[model samples]
Target: MVTGRVARITDFGAFIQFENGEVGLVHISQIAHSYVRNVSDYLQEGQTIEVKVLGRDEKGRLDLSIKELQDAPEEMPRPRMIGRQSPEFENKLRSFLRDAKERGPGEKGGKKRKK
Candidate 1:
């Protein structure tokens, strides 16, 4: 297993600088099983991720994988949308907006006045 803080994330891959000063590219294809069109969805600069060393390529560069940590499992459950706010909540929101507008700029409301 290779461990390192992500140096940077790019559409093509993440650049990881190892402790020994060697840097490696963890290609987007290897970040996850799901389609990864944007590498930012899976990684961020300074974020640490564990990678498994698959093998060295013909050029003697390391090939890394993030998916080796797991076996294929059942599809993830879809997130449920919560219920809408009640009428009472809407009434409160309207009151708040009206009050804020009434206060106007330079008042207690959240508006900045020209100096």
Candidate 2:
């Protein structure tokens, strides 16, 4: 991991410079685990942050993700699985499809037949 100061901010990402005079880009996608709508929301110009090196891109510029240097994210709670594939579900779906088909032509809440 390298510690660097944010050099500049752009619509795409933030530029940072390390102690050894090497500069790298921390792309918006790599700045955090959550959706980053804007680069300035999570980072400020001149902020010091640690980033893990992900090697270089095609242009020889260093690619990094600040999220990698941070601690592992907390596990989110999984939704309760009530075993979705029950025989009852299949029967209900089949009946609904059949009824929707029979009532047809914009009246059964199904698609209207293309003219």
Candidate 3:
């Protein structure tokens, strides 16, 4: 873990300057395990923080994460969906189509008795 002072802040993330003059970016998602509205809400300029190295980006710049040092929150269970149609539904649909076809257009009621 490297200890660094907040060098800069942006809507996206914060930049930190390490002791050896190395600077790295900590993305907003890596700042905390909870929803963060602003980077300053968690980190202030000149404030020091401990961050774990998350390897480097394609440009060789260091990538860091503060959430990595903390315990992860438990995932909530999702409700089961019981909305599948039964195989017999196909037969019911066919029956309904056949009945509608038997009932010709302009026919309001089920049947009209012969006068």
Q: Which candidate has the highest lDDT of all?
A: 3
lDDT of each: 0.81, 0.86, 0.89
| Tens digits of per-residue lDDT for model 1, 85-114 | 999999999988887887775586355445
Best by TM-score: 3
Instruction: Report the poorest 10 consecutive residues by lDDT, candidate 2.
Output: 106-115
Tens digits of per-residue lDDT for model 3, 1-115: 8899999999999999999999999999999888888999999999999999999999999999999998888974567888968879978988777766777676655454354
> How far is each candidate from the true structure, as Cα RMSD in Å?
11.3, 6.4, 8.8
What's model 3's TM-score? Answer: 0.64
Query: Over 4 Å off in model 1, which ranges?
Result: 75-115
Ranked by lDDT, top first = 3, 2, 1
TM-score of each: 0.59, 0.63, 0.64
Lowest lDDT sum, 10 consecutive residues, model 3, at 106-115
